[model samples]
Target chain A: MEQGQTMRGADAVIKVLAAHGTTTVFGYPGGAIMPIYDALYGSEVDHLLSRHEQGAAFAALGYARASGKTGVCFATSGPGATNLVTSLADALLDSIPVVAITGQVASAVVGTDAFQEIDVLGMSLAVTKHSFMVRSIDELVPTLYKAFEVAASGRPGPVLVDIPKDIQLAEMQYQTPLQALETPVVETISNLEQAKQLIRASKAPILYVGGGVGMAGAVEQLRDFAKQTGMPSVATLKGLGAMDKENPLYLGLLGMHGSKAGNLAVQASDLLLVVGARFDDRVTGRLDSFASKAKVVHLDIDAAELGKLRAPDVAITEDLREVLPALSMTLDIEPWKAEVAALKAEHEFNYNHPGSLVFAPRMLRTLADKLPEDSVVSCDVGQHQMWVAQHMWFRRPEDHLSSSGLGTMGFGLPSGIGAQVARPDAKVVVVSGDGSIMMNIQELTTIKRRKLPVKILLLDNQKLGMVKQWQHLFFEERFSETDLSDNPDFVTLASAFDIPGKQISTAEEVEPALDEMLNSEGPYFLHVAIDDAFNVWPLVPPGASNSDMIETLEKE
Target chain B: MMIHALELELHQRPEVLERILRVARHRGFKIIKMNMRSTSDVDATMELEVDSERTVDLLSNQLTKLVDVTQCRVLSSTQTAQTASL
Candidate 1:
């Protein structure tokens, strides 16, 4: 197996993917990519043919997030390759390991403006974690394998490999995957002792957990660390599943759209242990005001992220799963527990509001309560996304999937399909806004055709709810272009695709609607008309610090 | 702000320059000047002068992490003239 064997570049591509333990791939085939598809003809790997290249890319992303493995996707050159750009950017921002393989024009006509020729490698530069344009026969095998290595390694992200048609057809002496070993990422804790000292000396310490905790498989470690240290933790949207909701020391998600207590705790803390989470702008509204009182200890696998935004008092660059338990054993903080408990009680998520208007948050909470504990909810970006984040109960990080960093709309349907494929036993649901569901509404056809049991929960406010809330709050209710009152009847739309669906408008209909969606054995769509006046609470206004997060807006 | 000079050894691959520059731009470091010399058919040496309000060690550390970059180091302050000549 260590010896080199002769094979076509296209065959080598398939071999490399299989060697990396890839069980499935999402792709669409075309002229330039014919050879690769031809090579895949007799292979045991399952290749899902999506309706669009974008859908394929997003499905791959969802598969990666759900399975905790590098997702593989393939597309032809030009439009097919270009369509993957959005998902690539989304994957890069969210740090999902996705390997996107694209076909290109023949090597001879690469720069000659050949039909369907585009510089895919050049276009994907900004979005991909790394990219390789296979120029030679020998480069194909190593490059493809390297793409997997880089995509799944430290601070995982999307990687691209563009192979010209000629190269795919070319014969090459390929080295076995075992012979070409991936460069192993060595973990080094630069300042572990110093980080422990900071954690021990603080009276009021908070664990600021992020998506990295989940990516690094450190959720258990984080829980153990928090439990032992008596440190109340607040998670980012991506960090939702990292901490158990039942844990008393666990505060709800922090930052913009965070719980009132979570933001306040971060603002009040003396020591902020930032584990696996970058201080994104959304997490720290006005940078200076966020955690201004806290001495920071930032630990991440990526060294570049250490001092990129907020400088840490102690920075430890190491895998979270390793660093967390090591530091947890050194902690002895019993005095901080009661103070954190008090803050949790003070800033609890209040579901009770004064009106009979159907609150979106309450509806989502009810749905979450009714659903199975292992249910995976894919959410599109909007008020609904924030609502789900604030209310949904997730037992694990991958249970709730959102385009958090890229804030990409139309991510729900495709991601739901991918999640269902990845976890067949778990119930898969997509929570989308009326405005957002329309972005990739066509995926409904894909869902129906694939026979995937995906439940679609549509919160229709008849407007771009989040944007409308912003316009109402920040722009004095000018309401410019945010309204979607003229939207088509979603039930009818779902019916056209032969997916069973229902529409609900009142609070009484909420439970039954959720039951219908959950009880059904196949695809179901539930469209709930929510109150347009409802906005995600505990929102840190733009340019304001996390400390200035407003729990509710004043009546107009 | 200080003018920091760094020497980087990189793989001669497509868009390598843009990727390196992107990392610098992301860190809010401004590129004052840059020169690339092909040391071999596969390897290249890049001399960069960056204007930054951060420590040179930080930038060097990040640069070295790039997949294309095999080696990166911040030169002494006296080496600014040598980079200017490049």
Candidate 2:
């Protein structure tokens, strides 16, 4: 620590990020952020310039999802900062750890509506875990460190820091990383014995796993807890990879598109061991009717989420990593396990369409079987996202990343690039809908330039499939603005980017096309044209409870 | 619903009050009355009356986690703390 040393605020931003062990950042540079880019020129940290600020933000989200680290992004003021709003909201809802840095207008013209001036801090307050608008150069160092801490701490989510231009240019005595601030620790509760007692007393207990298990790095503990208690476990959409798909104790995804067994098990449970999951409306369906038979023991890191939805018989606020193992030490519920097994055997997810048409779910299952064990799949929202969730076999939660909470379109491509960059050794795949692919199609240039070996599987049905299905079921098929019949040939579009691609329109072509894409060297795209009339089954219609989901289309 | 009053002492940084207000709003509490007086160049004391269906402890615990907040406590409440009935 040199006593007389001084550095520009922009340089300090880079230094602080490096000190926090951030190796790469996904972002775009603009007028206000130029000073920071200049500081980044010769730095060891990698700056990946994305095609758009939205892409940069989603890519950082992908990086965070793939590698359990805080993702970083930077953008200039006004439009650049505004572009990141959707990403921030996406991260906030899904609980992804991201730190977004935006350069604001100089302090003098902050409220004068100067060129490229918008209040980034004011706009981002509701969407971020925490936000800081640095008013002085002296506050920069502490604010930077605080931003990282808040983003990565308990119940992780995005945090934003808006640095005005004056602060970036002002030179000040640089300070080292501040003494580690008090991160929110889920206070170690003394209710473990009470929770264990309730578990031991219950006959039909089900372990409900959520995204918090993955965020806490407690995948193994979750599995062990379920096994030791002999309780069947079900996962929310974001909690998909927390348990092995093939594990007998685990049921497939549970929510709007949850499996029959998964939903039925919840209905029959007498005790619900809810771990690391907030019971969202999608999962709960009709709030009043959800898990009506069960007494819940809710465990979460955030106290706010504990009793927000369903009242718990015992609410323990602690990390799942600590809570799961502690409570599972001596539970023996063979009878509950037997009941869960019976339900699983009777109501397992089945894909018997009785036709040769290339069904999206079956195709996804086939692709899942061929993918490498450590492969990462980033999916865009719509029917394809639900199909992948219902079919894909993830060994761990990190293997699958998607905008689960926000359900944002166009998240797959940039997210794939970020995932590939984060884990070079692992295979990366992007599953996107035709509509979603067009949203951020320019990211193909980024993939080509970086030479990332990302496989893009575009499920093209010539329509916004999910919206069309909803219209058919709820609006008497008066589909409005859901048609995309005039879409360009996807393979030709990929070719223009100098990326090799192939299109499959039949069931027979599915396996070979997937194999070709997976085996190919650098970035490859596969356009699979499937039936536009297809609908995701087991849909819980609007206002219907999870238990009342329509298992067959005829019921709708 | 009950009325709860909180007295907070905190470092006077940007968004300090906004952050506290945000938490108050999130906990389904309406700020009925507020009074702020500076304690020092960098510190300030705030008194707030919140209308809430939730308990005072829930609001106080979340407020304690804020970075700028040095201290927060429940000054008074209209109702006695209730035990979990379920």
Candidate 3:
């Protein structure tokens, strides 16, 4: 080998990563990963400088989910690495693909009380699909290839790769793998006859699709199968944008604050074909009553997910992209389409306002209508998210972005940064609750520095609305410690970042506020005050059937 | 035919996940899983269902002493196998 051709461990890591087609990475630089940063300088990978390590991880996640590829992110040792745990857990739960790279202490200094040293691999165990540490420089390329493969394989999820300081400083041959080791599908159910027979035997068929289906690129096949079966189709919040909101057969999102029609359809259905969905609690109001009328037909890529919750009458384990087409070929649903559509129409969402003080739902609808048809909106977990899912119409698929799987509080602001980075052409907005916003408030710096147009709509209810509702329903009407009277002025907070903010109080102000934000040259933050007593509606009581939802509080 | 679990204690930090899975995938451990929780009183348990006892011991003894991790052990499953065993 030529003398100048040789490189150190960190340089090798960068070279190998570039070989794997990584162009963008989000991370922060520090003591342990300085070698990596040096290696990345003047390299192919364009690293987005993040204000915090947590924001970096989430930005990578947003990139991975939107592009359907493995997202790459980097962080320093200890706190830098630990900050990525929440985003990794979020990606793992929802099966979004990401590869988080972290630096570690030197080999000799590992066990000693080394500064900035931490076991990144240990802390992220439950949250990642797979993780690794590069002991020797020779293992760099193989480990990186494996990390990407694990992140993008069947049942996609986050994978973490930790590089030790000594390893990053070592020198070795940097040969990138020509191809990744494809993880073979473990289990499959090819008996289309069984699935078809089960579908044929049931009277009311309800299709429950989750983010898995969307991630599997089975949206078209899922819609076709639902159309052919002539069943009511409902999606989880992560599964939103999979079905058109206006489709006659579409039942809208299901679970807490899920459209009444969608939940009723699930309860009334005799046959439930839950494809690639993990019936999360937010989607299943009452676990016992979810699809009570239906004999479930579970179709998913992961074998472990099959009987995890409700037992399936027919468990067909295979890629939904492949199995769906095969099933559709054998069944004909032209005759039953109209009847299913009519049934779906009955359960549609309705929000007829009676001249209230600040109708939040209408604001969402107006935003939905006014925004560019392809604009993407992500929300933090709260009442506002449910309200948007119910009332806002998403024209394009994969347009609405919210932390549905992990339900992380501070996910919106950072993830909005990611969303903006991923699709610079599309307008990205974040609808956050007062509580949720304060969690990741530091990310405001990211927007200011990057100059990314992420319009933030902060809903200030001065309370933890969702918890308040739960306490009201199950806690004997006692509101408990959910109230939040002392809160930062959002307009002032936005001003701190040198970004403009507007204080909006009524639905009448929504359009003008949106116009001001869009027309503005820089990022804008809008704080809209909402009534505290307003509860997220259409809730299913515990252990009740999907049909039995408490739309409004029982007249006590 | 041994059902064992191990407790791996690393600096309550992130990159340790890579070290654990690296060893697992390297050694070809069939089903290795870990769960995380805030630990003030008890241990953070890392469990593995390996195919052989030698592999289990090697993993447990070698990895338990890693820098950030505090404790590593092999635990047995409480639930008896109902279906045909793997």
Candidate whose DockQ is highest:
1
Candidate 2's residue-wise lDDT over A1-556, tens digit each? 4433688899889988888888899899998888999999999899888999999999999999999989999999999999999999999999999999999988989999999999888788778888899988888999888888889887899999999988999998887854755556556656888998888888888888889899989999988876666778889988999987668968888889988888888988889988888898888899888889899999888876767778889988776777887898555667767877888898866766666668888889988899887799999999999999998889888889988888899899998888999999888999999999999999998887788899999999999999999898989989999999999989999999889999888887878888999999998999998888778878888788777878777532
Q: What is the lDDT of residue A140 in candidate 1?
A: 81
Question: In model 1, which residue pairs have backbone atoms overlapping below 3 Å?
Answer: none
Model 3 agreement with the true structure over A316-405: per-residue lDDT tens digits: 767787788776633345444455566556655455665545678878887788888657787888888888888787754467777777
Pairs clashing within candidate 2: none
Find the 10 residues in a row with the least total lDDT in model 1 chain A: A177-186
Cα deviation of A178, candidate 3, in Å = 4.2
The ten-residue window of minimal lDDT in model 3 chain A covers: A329-338
Give the deviation of candidate 3 from the true structure as CA RMSD: 7.7
The prediction achieving the highest lDDT against the true structure is 2
Better of 2 and 3 by DockQ: 2
Comparing only chain B with the true structure, the TM-scores of all models are 0.83, 0.87, 0.61
Off by over 4 Å in 3: A1-5, A178-189, A329-348, A554-556, B1-86
> How should the candidates be ordered by DockQ, best one leading?
1, 2, 3
What DockQ does candidate 3 have relative to the true complex?
0.08
Off by over 4 Å in 1: A1-7, A178-188, A330-335, A354-357, A554-556, B25-27, B52-62, B76-86
Q: Interface RMSD values for the candidates, listed in order?
A: 2.3, 2.6, 11.1
Residue lDDT tens for model 3, B1-86: 44456656555544555566665655545454557664654334454555443335556644653434677766653332542244
